[model samples]
Target: MENTKQQKTNVSSKTRTLVSAALFAGIICITIAYFLHIPIGGNGGFVHVGDAFIYLAAVLLPTPYAACSATIGAGMADILTGSANWALATIIIKPILVLFFTNKSKKIINTRNVCAAIIAGIVGTVLYMIAEGIMYGSFVSAFVLSLVGLVQPIGSFIVFVVIGLVFDKLKIKEMIK
Candidate 1:
């Protein structure tokens, strides 16, 4: 009975460690994305850094945790940047983007996944554009926002693929609890 109790404690501790690691990695990736966003519109038009990080988190962490982290991290960044008004959108969009991949976990991460990521990125970007475009009207310009959506995903895909490759090489996934 004593040994069984000790074993339970050890399992609990390991679970805590895994959760902490996932949260830490998520925050760090969010921070990286936060710094990457370029301010464009006077209100808050920008490219998100969290895109790659969200994608990475989804691939590595559990679906729920990955989605939570992506939403919280991106939303926090929006608030920090004085785009507090758009926090809801950031929170909503990031998780949905993360969920896109999480829902299809059976599929291997490869060229096809990359293409899907690209599509999701563009779709998310366009959603943001439409939201802001409504407020800014014709003056804000969808052309630039559209370009950002198109380009950022390609950049994000490259980043995620490289990170995934590194994890494969280092056998990090084997360490996941």
Candidate 2:
């Protein structure tokens, strides 16, 4: 019983440490993304650093941690740019993808994982498109919306794949465990 209690306490402490690290790392990435905004597709946004953090969180952290990291990370940029509405959708969607898709004990960043990540990104983008289109009619056409959703995921996949390769070569995969 004492050993079990000690083990539980260690797990709890480790979880807390990872969660705090993710939160802080998320904030840092979001700040950099804000300063270096790169727009893609009609409504899709892009960033170099944001993906690194998201992919890392998805690979290393649990669902809740990944979700919180994505929400706070990307949402921070959206909030700062006076786009509170966009921030809200990002907070909901990005983390859901990271969490749901990365549930198994699998590395979340790799060539194969990038393919899975691409599919997940499309799902996330489509979700945002549907929600935003319904609320604001921001999409000029359904076709355009479809294209935007597809293109962004493809772009993200390509970018993250490259980043994943770099990280893999550098043996960052070990860090995720």
In model 1, which residue pairs have backbone atoms overlapping below 3 Å? 33-49, 33-50
Predictions: Cα RMSD each: 3.6, 4.0
Lowest-sum lDDT 10-residue window in model 1: 102-111
Worst 10 residues of 2 by lDDT: 40-49
lDDT digits (tens) for residues 35-154 of candidate 1: 577666566756655577777677666677777777777777777777887777777777788666652443336565577678778778777877677666752576566665565667
| Model 2 TM-score (2 dp) | 0.70
As a whole number from 0 to 100, the lDDT of residue 137 in candidate 2 is: 73
Error of 2 at 97 (Å): 1.4
